[model samples]
Target chain A: MSEPRFALGQRVRIAARDVAVHHRVPAYAQGHVGTVERICGLYGQPETYIHGDGQPFTRLYRISLAQTDLWPDYSGSSRDRLDIEIFEHWLEASS
Target chain B: MSDHHDHDHARTFQPDHTEPTSDAALLGLALRELLISDGHYTAQEELRMMDAMQKASPHNGALLAARAWTDPDFKHRLLNDGANAIKEMGFNLLPIEFTVHENTDSTHNVIVCTLCSCYPRGLLGMSPAWYKSKNYRARVVREPRTVLKEFGVQLGNDVEVRVHDSTAELRYMVLPQRPRGTEGWSAEQLAAVVTRDALIGTQRDLDINAVAD
Candidate 1:
């Protein structure tokens, strides 16, 4: 297992690149910024697993985003949040 | 802007979306046949597994939640190490990581799989059809409050709603706060009000006095 590059409570942005194959990153979360809510342990990347690749564990982080930040027209209260699991490789440090 | 006649005509020719074939069912059948033929597993073993899964329902989760609600020490252990805590209750969740999110007066927790429908099947049985729908998968992360409202869970402005997307290895189940007016109820009686939807965080306001049939 590789050491996680990002720490809990660190701000990170999801990579905006498009992948043609199997991937776990949701299209809605792409290019969005969130704080690492938890270190959800290391696991084999699903993108590689679908291609028959062996276990190449990577840190999975539960990133938390305010609902209003994700959607411009969000109708809920600003206190609402959405947590998405993102692999370490797909996250970039946010400025 | 749309005419009533046009809407009625469109509804007449609507496709039978409910009758769509399940590719997962077909694939499961094929895999089971192959595995049995190859002697990897026998039909009898598969039947036993199916029976076990059938017996696994929301009641199991309700029992656990009822225990947590009555016993503070058990609740602490359940929140700390869910997998081990469930094991103590005779459930063997070996490989799957189980996590319990407690709902309080100020905060509410809901579980969803934005990537795919990953759920705590060992405790709550199979995921509901709505949980796997594309609209839910896409909208819940973006508009959880709206989706939850459709399921009759309306939170106050002061309450924070947190949606947990189970996109990876962890499976989550919400431990809803015990409803009022049920102070002297036993664990079994309390479990009656712990509906499957409540365990999933969609229905929080449970009527504790109603008896299960």
Candidate 2:
């Protein structure tokens, strides 16, 4: 079994990239910094799963980000937060 | 289960768009027929699976939540290992990751599938049409408070709202806080108040009076 890349509460940033195919990372979450809320178990890469390529399991993490930080004009209470599940390959540790 | 099945009727795609049934429905029927004829799966087995899926509803989740609310030890197990905890309740949740997010006075949670309409269909049956809408998938993460407001869930400023985007394999269901004034209610009674919307985290207030309705 492969170890998880990031631990809970660890701050990490989503890698901003433009992909032309199926991916789990949403457009709103790209390049946003958030803390790992939960270390969701490993799963096959979704981009490959759609094409029937299910191998090499990747770690998944649920990262939590403040709504204010995610959107420039987020018209909501500042305490609101958004949690998105991101794969290990799409994240980088932020020091 | 107030016969609110009309929600799916307002979906963007109509069943009679091209023929008597939608293209996707026609394709699904053809695929099922081919699979049965090819000996991949029997029609009886397929019908049994469909019946099992239809039997799954929010009642399963409500029973789990009600049990947890009344039992501290069960609640601990539920929060720590949701899959096993649910299994202990005599339900099999295989090939899917099920996580329970607890709601408290300080924090609230909502669930959404940003990538697609991935949901805990084994436990909650079919997902609401709004949950699979393009608008909901796009806006819930960006403006959860606003989307929740549209759902009539207004959180107090002191309580921080958290939106869980089910983008990957893991599925989430909110363990809504036990409603007040039901202090001595039976587990069956408590489960009666728990609606599908409450389990999905769209609605916070679970009305005991609504149980009669």
Candidate 3:
């Protein structure tokens, strides 16, 4: 298992890999920038878990993305947000 | 044991979504038979597991929610480490990660499984069918305010709506803010007010009417 690369409160971007496979990140969340709200303990990667091999469990994080940043014409409160659990490989350090 | 059989509403989930049912059912039956035939699990074992899962109801989660309302320390532990907290309550948790979101004055929390119907079954029982519907899975993340309105829950712009999308790794159960009045009700009495809909966040306030006289 790989050690967690991201820390809580760190800004990270979800990779925009849109190719069709068993991916966990929803299409709407691709390429979105969000802050890591938590460092969930290591777990099996879903992309591989579907194909019968989920070895090398890696880090997962609960990311908080602003609701306004996600939708083009979001009309809700500015404080609205989306919390999603993301696996490590799909994330990269963001500014 | 609320089946939440409120499908009478026309627009919640498309009641006519019968396009792919047979295909999924065929696949499910095939998988079950294969598992039994291969001895990975017997038919009786499969039935027993189904019964166990079905036996789990929203009552378990209601107990915890009511407990949190009554016990400050337990509430803290539940919010901080949901997995251990539920286990401490004598409930068997699955290997999957468990987390709880608390509703507050400034923010209202709701849960959805955009990818699939991933729910905290051990704590809250089988998710209502609408939760697994294509309509809810797609709309809850997009227009939560409108969805809440459909459920008769109207929140002002002041309360930020926070939607938690279950990406399947971590399961979530929402802790609703306890309603005012019934100041000295027992924990069991308080549990009666926290509906599964409120626990899921589509509904916010507890239905005090549910408390037995």
Q: Please tell me which predicted candidate would have the highest lDDT against the true structure.
A: 3
lDDT of 2 by residue, B42-129 (tens): 7567667778888999899999999999998998988887887899998767656788989998888899998889888888899999
State each candidate's clash count. Answer: 0, 0, 0
Model 2 regions lying over 4 Å from their true place:
B1-27, B33-39
Better of 2 and 3 by TM-score: 3
- Runs in model 1 deviating more than 4 A are B1-28
Angstrom error at residue B190, model 3: 0.5
Candidate 2 has a TM-score of 0.88
Summarize candidate 3's per-residue lDDT along A2-94 as a digit string, tens digits: 668998899999999966668788999999999999898888777778777776687889999998999989888888899998988999999
Candidate 2 positional error at B137, Å: 2.5
lDDT of 1 at B149: 91
Give the per-residue lDDT digits (tens) of candidate 1, residues B1-213: 323325222222223434325898657655755667688976667667767887789998999999999999999999988888988778766566688889999999998998779988867898899999999888878878888899988888889999998878888889999999989889989999898888888888888657755
Which model is ahead, 1 or 2, in terms of lDDT?
2
Considering lDDT, which of the candidate structures 1 and 3 is the better prediction for this target? 3
**List-wise, what DockQ does each model earn?**
0.67, 0.75, 0.84
